[model samples]
Target chain A: MAHDTTIQTAGHDEHHHESPVVFGFWVYLMTDCIIFGTLFATFAVLRNQFNGGPNGHQLFEIGGLALETALLLISSITYGFGMIAAHKNEINKVIVWLGITFLLGLGFVGLEVKEFIGLIHEGAGPDRSAFLSAFFTLVSTHGLHVSFGLLWILTLMVQLAGTKTIPERMMSKLTCLSLFWHFLDIVWICVFTYVYLASMI
Target chain B: MSEHNTTSSGESHGSVSSYIIGFVLAVILTVLSFAIVVTHSLSPSATILTLSLLAIIQVVVHLHYFLHMGGHSEHRWNNICFVFTIGFVSIVIIGTLFVMNNAAVQMMSR
Candidate 1:
């Protein structure tokens, strides 16, 4: 009976600690949602205001966008696997999954930047039209988030080197970073479908 | 449902199969969306509407399988807050675009 009481008390204490981290991560997600919200609104307002320049239908290439979308969406799934590995206390597996995710994210960004350069070569830069301006803003905002997430994952890898699995400090940071990473994936889905696929139509 | 929060520390939890399923669905949706665009079967407005719906579904998949959102937690308020944010943003985007687009058309005609 004494052991049972101690176990119950310990469980309660862990709950008390976990709730704050979960709630804090949720708050961060809300703020990030707001940022994406603003970008979506900006895109909506400027989508058709091309100022006599090439519009979405003329510029977007569905083949290239498909590749970019695949990279980002797959990365999100890889990150989920990383979290699962972390939960199991498999430190090496966690690091490997995260490394894969980071590389996939970098690949997505590389494709996006290359696409932008291709557009410039075709004389369809952001300054050429209001539509291009909105396109660059919405897409680049997501790319910037991916870049930051990569940096955060690198930092966490270093911190996790000496830390035990499910350590409170590391869990908090991972929880937040996980939310951010998944959020970017969600944003990319929107961009791929609306900006790329719809434009091609 | 239990009052005790079961912290499965160092114990593997969450189904791996779900992540794989979500990833597959995402790829299928992307391919289907691109197929529609490449074929150009729909008009611009229709294409935009359809694609946006697909995007929303993809977002839901990522949220559920990847983020593991939506469950009984002490922080139900967080989910409620996120829903409200999405709603508010939708209104702002749609409403502003509608009003501004009309105003612009009117000014151009004048």
Candidate 2:
């Protein structure tokens, strides 16, 4: 039981913990990073492969992307706040901060879905050209990550709400989820800069 | 271990100032990248270079400030993993682009 607690109990130090869970989660995130790397590389190749359809310059709207960028970046900070709250074992504050993070995430995804639907309606759907396909795949994969993150946050909230004490389990989960949220933002920086801005210029 | 003591003392939670600094730096870099593009202030190559440079900096900022990836002794392995991931990711991206673009040029020319 002592070994089990040491192994499975939650951690607040996050990156400082010796538990395999944190290390394993970090490895998982790196693998996920490789996945994004491959996607970005694919986008790089096909970016100019418009095949007579509209290119990114004609299709991407900077205003929406800029807003989306702001929302996600802000949410990253908000999640940081949530993590800090978790570290202090301030459950209510953690909930409030994470709830705020969730809303920002939802807003960002709303804008992304709007962007995709708007593109498809304009006949610039993913199937229209290689460029569009790659763009859609890369951006939507990031968006899917955001969607999953929101779901994860929601579950964490539910679990935390019921628990009287802030369990190490909940903290570990929060730490991993926070790492993931920040990772997505880092990827978004690349996507917006390379995929959207680079395409434009 | 000293690392365990420091973390147990709650020093590892990362200061609010750090998060604020990271947030501000990230927003500035993001806006700067977009501004360069929207204004067309630089040549195409320069714009791409600047954006790429800023993107790299922003990722580092997130890792440092938000992710608590400071050079803590206990986080030595996580730091190594991060470095390795960056290396791997760069190789994949650069290699893919190199191979595909070369093949693409030949195919198009032929």
> What are the interface RMSDs of all the models?
5.5, 6.0
The DockQ of each candidate is 0.47, 0.49
- Candidate 1 Cα outliers beyond 4 Å, as residue runs: A1-17, A162-166, B1-13
Q: Which candidate number maximizes DockQ?
A: 2
Number of clashes recorded per candidate: 0, 1
Winning model by lDDT? 2
Q: What lDDT tens digits, residue by residue, belong to model 1 across residues B26-54?
A: 88877778877788788878877778787
Q: What is the TM-score of chain A alone in each candidate?
A: 0.87, 0.91
Clashing pairs in 2: A10-A168
Tens digit per residue, CA lDDT, model 2, A1-201: 222232223254444454567778999999999999999999988887778899889888899999999999999999987876676677899999999999999999999999899999999999999989999999999999999999999999988895667766666788789889998998898899889999899
Q: Which 10-residue span in candidate 2 chain A carries the lowest summed lDDT?
A: A1-10
- Tens-place lDDT per residue, model 1, A1-201, is 222342343342243334477677787778778888888788877787788899887888766787888888889888888876665567888888889998998999899899999998999998998889989989988889899899998988877776655576676677678888988888888887767666666
